[model samples]
Target: MRYAVSNQPEGATFQVWRGVLAGASASLVGIGLARFAYTPLLPAIIGAHWFPASTAAYLGAANLGGYLVGALSAGALVRHARPATVLRAMMLLATIAFIACAFPVSFAWFFVWRLASGISGGALMVLAAPTILAHVAPSRRGFAGGAIFTGIGLGIAASGTIVPLLLREGLRQTWLGLAAVSLLLTVIAWNGWPAQDAPSSPVNEQPKAKSPPAPALRALFAEYGLNAVGLVPHMIFLVDYVARGLGKGVDAGAQYWVLYGLGAIAGPLLSGHLADRAGFGRALRVALVLQLVAVVLPVIASGAALLMVSSVVVGAFTPGIVPLVLGRVNELLAHHPAAQKRAWRTATTSFAVMQAASAYGLSFLFSHSGGDYRLLFAIGAAALGVAFVVDVVAVARSK
Candidate 1:
């Protein structure tokens, strides 16, 4: 009866929409304004002032590194801190960093700011997942989680679309404007946020622990890390692979990007909902199959129709898997409050580690392979195949 329905009224249904919006806005500062905007705007910033490409890449990586640390800290800290409070602090840090970029600081100073932004970005993502899902009933958590992940894609798309238009205003102005928007979003999150789900404790009280061994949850954390590797290829390099590897022009690449983003936005919610009804494992298998088709289609057909189809298929399933994965992680740690904290900490740390690995792998592959990314696509397809197997095995064993 734990997952049984309550005799609630129409107004008492799952808060999936609200959770998704909160997730989107929270994610915008982290994924869009802070983390993602830098990619497109970097060229402009470099052009405006001279900086070596290596230094810029390093600075960018610094942000990712910061995310790793922040995620670990937030996962444990969320047990003590209210989710809204943590999100607000992270948002504030990200906003300030964006505005600070306008000041034209020294290379060392810029790296520090980037690091701060990265930390906030990581924290925001980890906190948002659970915070949003907690608002929904347990039966609906999968759908809610998937819906919430759409926020990340929305943020990415917004950054891609907005930064290019704002390039005319100069990087400094754009940075300031992004900062202002972030601050406004933070305020909205503060007012609308629900009460914290963690146990209450006084300032001098010890952090409470729920009954359970930590090792079980730690195993789930390792699985999360593996899942991260499974997800990276389609996300980070899909656009470049389509453009350079497939011989499409920039315009075609942009179109494919739009398609993929749209898929990312839509896929999670649909998959999550389906996962809830059909079982998470079955839903995941379905998504992975579609994603595989998306990955491999370009190997044969490089035309616009196939390219767009590929983007959409890949996009649809890409972000959707996150919610399902987190839901499973949550199931493992449900009995122990302290365990939840530890598990989240592990999830965040693993997330950052995976992202770093994925980025490095893509860069190394491209560098050594003379920018031919077909092999990269093949590798991605293979990884997903393995992930599909894992999902099947996990589900079958659980049953």
Candidate 2:
């Protein structure tokens, strides 16, 4: 804890440790952990009741929809208030949303609850990036950001591992236990991430002040939005591609996910270090191209060896690219405070919207194509290729 706190910046002394915990906990409970629990837990939940599989899936789509709403809400609200306060409040909302899962209800009600949870959780994720980066030293931003986002991976893995074990007890008991954990996470965020006043604008006194207009905002949104469309098929479908589509068992799929998490942990740390040395934009472009290659693996190979290799490559590609994207966005607007804010907001909100679109598209594809994941995988590969081109153009234009 002391080591983690040492690199935390000045003005962060009283609150840095708490902020990390708050950010990490908010990620764990708000979006990654709580929101994703539905997927792994769905089998157990459905086994206990006799609901249609499609209806259960609707709950997921509803959550993504709520996430889009929450993300937009956070962007609008954060401009007027401190980010930490927004993060804490959203964490509380997400906790309650997760708890909503504990009760047995009709599919329609489940959809509503999930939508609320997604909106809250999405805001929580958006709030976290700025709140953590704003307080940290510029030199340490990438590493700290990586450490912070890793919480999402941890939370997601925890939910995956826990949901199955809890089912051994009973559906109600399983959900109750998860709800308890989410509540604990909420308490941590509310208490640990207490708000601090934002520093006064450093450039307000200068005569050369510039602010981004609607045109700039739209441009940033388009760049980030297209990038996100590429990630959706991969991030949302990786597990299913390995498990159901490839004829592998659930355990093997879980192992592949675990490998992904391990790659996630390693990739970010290494990418951050290298980005500092090689330049963020260049490094990020290389990484995106590599990911494009990784996404195409499923289409060419079907064995365990290819699957394992793909897991490692995709794992390294996905989360590793996040910090760099945010860092570049931060760089692009370094001269304009307002542009910086808008860039971050656009990046986040568009991310959620793209995720929802990806989910809906994948679900529709899976339904109609007679479960041919190959078409979806091909789509994912193409999106990644498009992302590479978009990123190159965006980076060049910014320069």
| Best-fitting candidate, scored by lDDT | 1
Q: List the residue pairs that clash in candidate 1.
A: 263-315, 264-315
- lDDT per residue as tens, model 1, 158-213: 65687777777877788888888888887766644445453332321445635444
Model 1 stretches astray by more than 4 angstroms:
1-20, 198-224, 334-338
* Clash count in backbone of candidate 1: 2
- What lDDT score is found at residue 121 in candidate 1? 85
Candidate 2 residue 264 Cα shift, in angstroms, is 3.5
- Which ten contiguous residues of candidate 1 have the minimum total lDDT? 1-10
Q: What is the C-alpha RMSD of each candidate to the true structure, in Å?
A: 5.8, 3.8
- At residue 64, candidate 2 shows an lDDT of 79
lDDT of 1: 0.70
Per-residue C-alpha lDDT of model 2 across residues 22-97, encoded as one tens digit per residue: 7777776766665667777777666767366767767767877887788778877777787766776777677666
- TM-score to native of every candidate shown: 0.84, 0.87
Best by TM-score: 2
